[model samples]
Target chain A: MKTNGIELEKEILDQLPAIVLAVDKNFNTLYANNAALTFMGSTPENVIGKHCYNMVRNPQCKTPECCIAQAMADGKVHSIRSEADGGTGNRFLESTAVPLKDEKGEIVGGLEFVLDITQKVLDEKKLNEQGRTIRDMSTPTIKLWDGILVLPVVGVIDTNRAQHMMDSMLNKILSSNSRAIIMDIQGVAAVDTAVANHLIKITKATKLMGCECLISGISPGVAKTLTQLGINLGSIKTKATLSDALEEAFSMINLRVITTEAKQ
Target chain B: MEADSFRLLNGVKAMMDSGDEYSVSGSVTNRCYIACINGELSSAQMGQLYDEIVRMAEKRELRGVIMDLNGLAVLDSAAFCVLRKISGALALMGLKSAWMGIKPAIASSLVDFGADVDDLCICQNIEDGVRLMSFQK
Candidate 1:
């Protein structure tokens, strides 16, 4: 009956999702279950009798505020987020350290349970990027070309939107391999020194990547603001309207311009 | 330090001075460089901080500004909006703003909040923040 009970306990421990490790008060590894060995990227042979910090390569071991150490000292459970160098690579883990006690209620050692959470973190990051993309798309000033790329703007440019525009434009250009980019800013509210500089950077980057960037729909107010900012847009080709910009872009790429009358 | 100078609460030092509170010391300048965050910066505090930073940009010529949030637990929507506003405002002022000392939990929270942290200069520590800011200058 005792043998059966031990076997049942072992089976339950093996089925746990988290890696469980038992360490002595001195931080020496006493016993690690199969999950622990797998998570620590080591076999039981190499892990046992070794210092937990040495086996885990945790820098916190040298610190007085080490979670495991604090847990052992206070005889309480301590939760901490730590990074570990798994055999594959560095991995982020959420670790909970619990003090182990004997039948007399005296603290003997600590037990650590770690759960890998790298995937969840990456997913969150990706979702955030997606949200930004969606927000950028909702800007009425932005116009999507070929239903894949966007070019929208008019008036004074804010640095935040400019950065977002640059990133979105670059991603679109790279992904779609589009030949032309048309930025229409007919309703732009204002332009300042910083906005002009950001525009210049974006134009230069776009052109360097073998894509032709065309500016169109520049309002008179924006032109005056650009002049006041001492920004020289002479190097960049701009048109008074989006249609003209598109026509210029098509001509540069050696594509014959189709007239609206012809399409009708 | 006097008892009133520093209070250990919620595992953080809350230093209350004469209408000013220094949350954490980033580095030692002539005076101890500290991050002054208003009490439990809610959504309104985020917007207020962003506006204050923008006003500072208009008044002084800064090469770069550092948004040190070592004292913050969570930067919610309003806080995230403030960061965005600061980034935009800095560009208008011909300056840069680097976010420094972002804890992983806060970083993850920002991600969860769908904040755009990509364009801004982010550093893990105050030292790295200073280094990056100087490099930009």
Candidate 2:
């Protein structure tokens, strides 16, 4: 156990898993643990008494935005993310610098801790990219048959997301020049009156744009809510399932999905 | 004696007819507890709002409550359940409530979720909702 003072115990510093470097007020590396030597590929004799930038070789060092410089100025801990050259490849480091104070409660120097965070950073970036991909794939417009564009909504329909769906559906309808659009909500977990009303608005807007909008996938529970609320969605065409909606779409365009083979 | 009697406690009996259009944070006026939906209310947040409404109702001892959803932008199924519970609790207190200015989309969603909205009175706007409570009494 070491006393609470600016003087750091060499035993404690050497045992730590991360690279620990003690710096004087002049920003000189007063002491560097064994891990720091292995990390920088330098020995104690060559590393100590050297400027922090010289030993670490970081472009950001000694600058106003440097973590060590910030901690020294504010007398608090500051952290920065930087890349370091590893034996195999480039590694990410989370460097934290804290103010070191003497027993008299006077700021003496800075204590820095550098942790390897290469794997963590890579994992986070992958997760973010995957989330973006999922969002992009969530809204898919399918042309099941000619003149019919089906947009199957499978997630929560909030105002912003609903707006996104509207924009995409309109674009697909315009491009396909489809006379009808079928919105299937079979994958949606729940429907509130707000969502029902949102669907109606989209349908009305589609009609205004000279396209017929039909909603499908009304579960039994959803039907009960609509009837009890005394809300009449009769003006908007609806079907029990996507197949039924597709059949209706076919009728609107004067076509049908014929199952019979051509006779000789 | 009565909850609305607090207005008379201040010794001002001659009241002007502002037509029940003023807003009070958490109080009852003209036998109605009116609050505008101004915050983002998830199901959890609705519980906090519900507790406050119940407290105000018990204190003012009002007979009617009106929730104004004019500025509301976000809500979930939890909000409807909380409203249902609040309605049930208020019913036991011999007080009824109404929802005003509900966006058509939200109403459609509530209806789609199989919520028994017949128990709650609804109004197209705040002025119409305030008038509803007055007519009921």
Clashes (backbone N, CA, C under 3 Å), per candidate, total 9, 12
Clashes of 1: 9
Per-residue lDDT of candidate 2, residues B51-108 (tens digit): 7788888887676788877566655677767777887888787777777655545544
State in Å the error of residue B32, model 1: 43
List TM-scores for all candidates, in order.
0.34, 0.50
User: Which tens-of-lDDT digit does each residue in A149-262 have in candidate 1?
Assistant: 337774446767776666667666645655577877776777778777676666654553335678887788889888877889886778988778877776755666555766
Model 1 C-alpha lDDT per residue in residues B46-114, reported as the tens digit of each score: 555666666655655555666667566666777667677877878787765666544434543454344
Please report, as a residue range, the 10-residue window in candidate 2 chain B with the lowest summed lDDT: B15-24
Best by TM-score: 2
**What is model 2's native contact fraction?**
0.00
lDDT of 1: 0.66
Query: Which candidate's lDDT is highest?
Result: 2
TM-score for chain B considered on its own, for each of the candidates: 0.64, 0.69
* Residue A136 displacement (Å), model 1: 3.6
